[model samples]
Target: MIEIKNLKKVYNDVTVVDIPHLTIAKGESVGLVGNNGAGKTTLFRMILDLIRPESGEIRSNGEVVAGHENWKTYTASYLDEGFLIDYLTPEEYLYFVGGLHQQNRAQVDETLAALGDFFNGEILNRGKYIRDLSKGNQCKVGVASCLLQNPQLLMLDEPFANIDPSTQFRLKNMLKDANKSKGITTIVSSHDLNHITDVCDRILLMEKGVIIKDIATNSSTLSELEDYFGVGQTLGSVPVAGIDEEENH
Candidate 1:
C-alpha cells in the first residue's frame, strides 16, 4: 500500500500541490488526469523521491519513501526522457536497470523477449547510445527498462505522448497483462482522455495543483467524465455535446 499524508510542494511562493491524504492499494491501476501545470508530474516525482516535498510524508508498504531502501526494490518510475543514461545503449540500459534490482542478464533477455515487437528488435541489439535514438524510441526503451524488473509499484507520466498508435496499443495491453498477472500497482498520467478511460480503474482529475475529482470507472462513463470536465453540458438526463453526438453516430 502507498499512503500520502498532508503532502505539499511549493515553488517560488506558488503552491504546486497540496494533498491532505491519498492512498493506493496493491493491484490497483489509477489514472491521474489534468491540463498542463496541474501538478500531476510534481506529485509523481514526490512519490518517487525524485523531488523533496516541502512538508508531509509518503509511505509505501509502511516504509517512508524518501529514505527507504525497499522503495528502490519495489518502485519503478518513468517520468521523463532524462531518466535514461545518454551514454548507454538500449540493451546496456536495460541490463543496468535490471542489475540494480539484482536481476541477471538472462532474466533481462527473457523479459525483453516477452515485450514482443514493441521494441522493434533494434532496441536490444542497437549499438548506438541512447542519446542517438528518437524521442519515441527513447520512450520505448525507457518504458521497457522500467518494466524489466516487474516492480510492484509502477508510475508513468505522459507515457503515450510520442508513441505511434500500434505501440500505444501494445503498451496498453502490456500494462493490463502486468497488472493482472503480477498484481502491480500502476499509476499513469495522460492527456488522452480515452486512454485513461480505457485503462484506469479510477480517475483523479487535478487542476492547478489540487485534486478536483476522483471518479471510479466502474460506476461512470466517458460521457459523465466529459460533463465533469466541463467539455459538455448535461441536457436533462443525457450529456449533450459533440462527443455524445459522435458516439451516437
Candidate 2:
C-alpha cells in the first residue's frame, strides 16, 4: 500500500531520515519503533507529503506521493494536536471532516456513538473548543477524526503518549479491529513497546534515520526490542519507552 525508496530528509546538513527502502502491505499492521531523532515522524510527514524530502521519494499505491492528490482520499493521519483546528469544537471538527467524505451529520454521529468506549465519555458534546481540552482528550478527538474518515491507510505518531491506560487499551483494540476486520493498513510509531507489539504484526526498528531491523512480531519480539534498547533485564514488565522525545522535526 505504501513504498519508500532511498528517502532522505535533512536539516542544517544533519540527516534526519535516510530510509533506503520500505514497503507496507495492504491490511498489514506495522509498528515503527525508534528513539528520539530516529526520524519516525519525519518519515511519516514525508509519506503524508506534509514536508518535501530533501531527496528520494515516497509512493502510496503506485503513484509518487510528492506531487499527488489521489492518496489523500484513502489516507488518514494524526501526528499531534497541530492537525486539529483548535478553535473548533470536537463535534464541529468531526462533522467537517465527515462532510469532506460526503458523510452527513447523522453518519458522523453514528460513528461517534460507536466510539463511545474509546472516547470514555470525555469527548463529544463537551461544548468547548478542541484547544480547551486536555492533551489526552485532544488526542481522543484527533484519533476519532481519523476513524471517521474510514481511511484505507492509517498512520499515527506517538499515539500512546498522553492517553491513560484504559484509553490505550481501547485504542489497541480499535487499531486491531481496523486492520483485521476492516482491512485498513496501519503504520503506528510509538515508544510503548508492549502496546506496539500487541497491535502490530510487524515491527521496524529505526536508529539515527535508518531502519536497523525489521522483525515480524512473535512471542519474543518485545524482549528482542528491549535487548536492543538495553532494558530487557532491568525493566521487567514495564513498557520500553523509546529514548526521549525527538526534538520537533
Candidate 3:
C-alpha cells in the first residue's frame, strides 16, 4: 500500500502539488488526470522520491519511501526519456536494469518473453543505440525494462504519449495482467481519458496544484467523467468552454 499525507511541493516559492492525504491499496490501478501544468508529474515524482517534497510524508507498506533500504527493489518508475541510457541498445538497457535488481540474464529473458508482442519487435536484438530509436520505440524500451523487475509498486508518466494504438492496447493488457496476477500497485498519468477509464480502478482529477476529484470507475460512467472534465460538444461541434484552443493552436 502507498500512503501520502500533507504532501506539498514548491518551486521558486510557487506551490505545485498539495495533497492533504491519499492512500492507494495493493492491487489497485489509479489514474491521475489533469490539464497541462496541473502538477500530475510533480506528484508522481514525489511518490518515487525523484524529487523532495517541501513538506509532508510518503510511505509504502508502512515504510518511508525516501530512505527505505528496499525501496528500489519494491518500486519501479519511468518518468521521462532521461531515465533511459542513451548509449545502450534496447535489449542491452533492459539487461542493465535487470542487473541492478539482481535478476539473471535467463530470468530477464523469461520476463521479456512474458511481455509478448507489447514491444512489437522494436526492442529485440537491434544493434542501434537507444538514442537512435524513435520516441515511441524508446518509450517501449523504458516500459519493458521497468516491468522486467516485476515491482510491487509501478508508476508511469505519459506511458502512451507517442506510442501507436496497437502497442498502447498491448500495454494496457500487460498492466491489467500485472495488477491481477502479481497484485501490483500501479499509478498512471495520461491525457487520454478513455485509456484511464478503461484500465484504472480509481481516478483523480487535478486542477492547478490540487486534486479536486477522486472517483472509482465502478461507481462512475465515462460520460460522468467527460462532464467532470468539462469536455463536451454542442450540435456535433466541440464546445468552446471545453476545448483547449490554445493547446490546439
Which candidate leads in TM-score? 2
lDDT of 1 at 71: 82
Name the lDDT of candidate 3.
0.81
Regions of candidate 1 where Cα sits further than 4 Å from its true position: 230-249
Clashes of each: 0, 0, 0
lDDT score, candidate 1: 0.81
Candidate 1 to truth, TM: 0.89
Worst 10 residues of 1 by lDDT: 235-244
lDDT by residue (tens digit), candidate 3, 46-157: 8878888989999888889886666777888888889999898887888899998899899999988976688777778768999999989888888888788779988989
Predicted model with the maximum lDDT:
2
**Ten residues in sequence with the least summed lDDT for candidate 2:** 240-249
- Estimate TM-scores for all models: 0.89, 0.92, 0.89
Q: Candidates sorted by lDDT, descending order?
A: 2, 1, 3
Backbone clashes (count) for model 2? 0
Candidate 1 residue lDDT tens string, 120-193: 66576767899998888899988998898678989989999998899889888888877888799999999888
Encode model 2's per-residue lDDT on 145-203: one tens digit a residue: 99999999999999999999999999999999999999999999999999999999988
